[model samples]
Target chain A: MAYALMIHPTDNVAVVTEAVRPGEDVLYEDANGGQVCLKAAGDVPVYHKIALRDIAPGEQVLKYGKTIGVATAPIAKGEHVHCHNIESPERKELI
Target chain B: MEFYGYRRSDGRVGIRNHVLILPASICASDTAEMIARQVNGAVSFHNQVGCSQVPSDMQYALDMMAGLAANPNVYGTIVVAAGCETCQCGMVMDAIAARTNKPLHGLIIQKEGGTIRLIEKAVRLAREMAAEASTLRREKFPVSELILGTECGGSDPTSGIAANPVIGKVSDALVADGGTVILSETTEFIGAESILADRAKDEHVRRRILEIVERYEQHFIRNGENVRLGNPTPGNKEGGLSTLEEKSLGCIHKGGESVIQAVYDYAKPIPTDVKGLVIMDTPGNDASSIAGMLAGGAQIVVFSSGRGTPLGSPIAPVIKITGNDATFRMMEDNIDFNAAPVITEQKKPAQLGEALYKMVLDCCDGKLSKAEALGFTETAVMRACNYV
Candidate 1:
């Protein structure tokens, strides 16, 4: 069974369907149905996002195929995506 | 395409037949509650807003009281009032009379001489109403007769991912079949107004969606408060949600993909012809939100939660659902159905939706939900708490 879910082809991140340990490999098919392998950078909790590839600091993060927030620091592929290293610029302004 | 329900004199269908003991003001709530308690087949809610409010807010309370009395779910009603309350019992009775031909009786404590005399009179009226309400029988109604209320509270990540999406699937089906769905909790719409605006059926609807959000924001600004300060609530944060917008996005998922037909004010019934999703301006408080939706004539409510809640309505039957599998196991008595399978088993939303609709039909056919079985009815009216 897939340990992560790629909601859409445009999404650069996938939500961990279950908890993952560091160094575990999860397989996913890309937009074109091409298989892509991702290595877990650290222990990621369930329902949290995992970077599918390298992301630069200050870049936007997409979830539900929409911009959920921007990264606060450089995030390597397979690392856990959460409030610690990202800030929701648009959502914060709404508050 | 049809479910069993009670047909009312007003040409409305109801899932439950209840004799309501309604209070016209806070002071009368105790008397109303006692009257309900003394009579079988009667119900009452804790009235929080009856007096001590700006004229406009008082009108909101009266509207809700009247609407509650006229709700299709109610077979009849007995309204009690503390004579001096600004929102008079007569006004509430008149409002309800304008809407329905149901059996109704109104009483005032001061006019009756004392609390003891009022309670005896209220109990007698409630007993008579309850006896009459008990004679009603369920009848089959077409799918178009249903007005669904969708709500979320104590949200967690799973709310957006599983529970809300499951409700969305149900929403889409009901709307496709020509039924009505009322999407509530305007405060939770913050940071997500544009998303909802994009789904409006017309330019007027789109602007109305935007206008209501702006009006709610103004309420906060006028009070020098930021709604964001309370969002992504402590329970939400503990459940893995990181931002208010994140919460809002997940919250709106319950609307499914239907185009919003129109925006409505609190407690006003939807036009019977408008067959799609509709938004009602209501506070995010679970009980009061349910009250607004019920007052608007929804026969049933499908409330979803991730952190879990036992909130129910005094009139409408609330089918409580949860996406948090852990919470489901933990709060087994409070949650009615589990949508956690959507996340755990990767179950399709449509599958869960079908199960939920079946459950809803069963509920309409007289099956009690966990909340209903536990007698967990609760309700209140919305009031602006901006320190004026």
Candidate 2:
């Protein structure tokens, strides 16, 4: 099982500890020794984010229990979450 | 809680007893470098600003130049200048004298007749200061006497999850022990301003926190530019930072969970009496940001770099830590601490923090950081406006 980490309880995504290939099982451990797993929908590089649930466009991509960005496209659970699918809302006003 | 350090005449403590060869303008930087090279325990960096700058911009350069010399890390300073420069050697020398009654010497290229003669005089001055500096033995001082500067650059996801959080633990430990810690890089605080403000020690600090963020944003907005245009740079993106908010949330971890007691402008001195965590308004550029903190009287700095860097300060030692095992393995020559085991081996961050705290104390006790050992004295000063 590939390991991942959820920095905060409210964070909607987790960071992979190592590169996970498509169809791999990404396991996340909690402080209480509890474990959660999600099957990787695609290749996710180490230190990259993976969605914990389906996210709709315009929805906040939560990490560290805060909005990192807004999803720009449909993202299924376990899908890679990166710049290609999410954009900074702050940039919209200026650019 | 105690470490060996040099106690300055100003009642401040310093980890290093360096003789600073300070260049007041760009024209004298080469001479300063040559003089420092000839003297043991002498340091100097290229100063690109000073001449041809508007008064406001020149003030920043002058403040940095003087503040650096005043930093307790320096045993004394030799201020070198070209006579025609806007930042005169006398002005900088006076600024340093105002900050502390430390030993100071001034020189001008025109008075000395050229670079060769100036270098000869400066080298003699620096040698005398270095000899005096070597005579003072280290005395034990409490860690509470230290003002620590925290910074992060070349960030990634692991930095937020591991290295920064580990630094957070150290921040809390230091603050709890009555030391001062500085959290800077206003640009990185863009999306996390509210979060930081909520932890302010009072309404004044709270309002100042928000004000600095607003001011930084407005400054960019007025220039017909947006901070998001360059933040979360391509490297940050590749390291899994998709937005400024994500990067900021990671960046603020270096401040730890302590309440912010005060806020300061760029390169201003951090008063010795102010304890606990404080915020310094600074740009996100690595070298310039570190310069601001060092000038603010930070005796030492802890810098977290996920991608790893070899950057060092001319005035103080910078301890580089990283959370990426790959980066740590690849750049061990430059990086001093490895926080990657918090992810790979599931080691506790607090445990690693304890180890890191020891390393910090060791650094204060005279251990040279990898960057310092390699003689990496990269320096830069913040500029408020363009040249006239």
Winning candidate number (TM-score): 2
lDDT values of the candidates? 0.84, 0.90
RMSD in order of candidates: 2.5, 2.0
DockQ of each: 0.34, 0.54
lDDT of 2 by residue, B182-209 (tens): 9999999977888999999999999998
Give the share of true interchain contacts found in each model: 0.23, 0.73
Off by over 4 Å in 2: A30-34, A91-95
Docking class of 2: medium
Number of colliding residue pairs in model 1:
0
Query: Candidate 2 on A20-85: residue-level lDDT in tens?
Result: 999999998654668988999999998999998899999998887888899999999999999889
lDDT of 1 by residue, B100-206 (tens): 99999999999999888999988888888877878887778888899999999999878888999999998999999889998998987876788999999999989
Q: Give the Cα error of residue B62 in candidate 2, in Å.
A: 1.6
- Model 2 RMSD in angstroms: 2.0
lDDT of 1: 0.84
